[model samples]
Target: MKPSIEYLQDAIEKLGVENDSKAAAALKISKQAICSYRSGERIMDDFTCIMVAKTLGIDGMEVIAAAQMEREKNEERREIWADFRKKFGVKAGIAGLAAALTLGSLAPSKANASNLELGAISCLESPVKLYIMSNLAWGGFSSKQQKCW
Candidate 1:
């Protein structure tokens, strides 16, 4: 699990808040709570993790699971939380990739329009096309027949 301070810093940076006090206000928490999170004296609660995730535009479950893992005392329960984090993180990544692909396909260029048609056909034909397209879009090698749509 990532440290609470890291999450706090990320929220502060991503929210463009000037200080911990401002971040606390934005997150609807006390400044002292922010200080406790920064000092690792306390892990964020589920609500705070959700707020952080919303601020970061990430999956709330991923952040919640990470916090749960950090707070769990039992090793087995910690592992469960870890598993939840991994699962939700992958789902969130896939959703992000899908959104990017959809946006790219919306470009006004004719070439992109053609790719959009190809992508629609591929989606109808095989779910595996999503995996291939995501890889190619991220700079993976692709054959002419496997071009990312």
Candidate 2:
């Protein structure tokens, strides 16, 4: 079972939300992530937990412990990118990507629904619609249902 959205909601509340910017401010992450975390669709990561705790002036270890009991929680998700690269070779435009990250974490699948979305169109074969999607280090982008040709 995962922690309830209320857990994050409570954490947010502890920080004393500014109301109007709740959603926008939280957009420091993806809307899907916020919704998923808040709705219990996914668990909060350690970075988020720590942020919440720090904003609330509480202890991170304590929050993580409580969060863990209700969810299959883990620490930061930065490791997911490295793991993805190890599992699947980076196709294109990934040369300086890992270097651009400030938090040492890669952003989610960036190129989508555009020319770059499919990488090199000619690189793909005819008679098959091809699109290149990066694995979002965390839960957004919904790559779970996709099957590449």
Candidate 3:
């Protein structure tokens, strides 16, 4: 509905695409991308629309809802995935922005990445977290006594 340039910009920044090149690189788009979108010369695809909507925390159905069955089936899955990946996205965004600004790794998927399909977080992945869990489980550790005592 509201496809203003300012709205597009806000959406772009919120999605961690704070600049033209970064936006183009991340979305595999081109310099004409934002211009086209803003000038009504081109239409953004479904995925970008969803991405923008999710990042901006806005209603995508303002145009057209994906579909009833797909919506119902994917809603829960999306929520769970969002919660888990939020932190990763934030960290990746920060590092990614630095890299992008420095003309380093523009795209994250190109460098020896694979799909692990993990359902849970690993311990070594976050030591501080697992350390707290370990302490809670073992009650306490006495380095001076050099024993569980």
RMSD values for the candidates in order, in angstroms, are 15.3, 16.7, 18.6
Worst lDDT 10-window in candidate 3? 62-71
Off by over 4 Å in 1: 110-149
TM-score, cand. 3 vs. native: 0.33
CA-lDDT, candidates in order: 0.78, 0.53, 0.53
Worst 10-residue lDDT window for candidate 2 reads 84-93
1 or 2, greater by TM-score: 1
- Which residue ranges in model 3 land beyond 4 Å of their true spot? 4-7, 15-18, 63-149
Instruction: For candidate 2, give the lDDT of residue 75.
Output: 36
Q: Where is the poorest 10-residue window by lDDT in model 1?
A: 127-136
lDDT string for model 1 (51-115, tens) is 99889887777777777888899999988878877777678789899999897765645664545
TM-score of each model, in listed order: 0.67, 0.37, 0.33
lDDT of model 3 at position 89 = 49
Error of 1 at 135 (Å): 45
Q: Let me know the TM-score candidate 1 reaches against the reference structure.
A: 0.67
For candidate 3, what is the lDDT? 0.53
Summed backbone clashes in each candidate are: 0, 1, 0
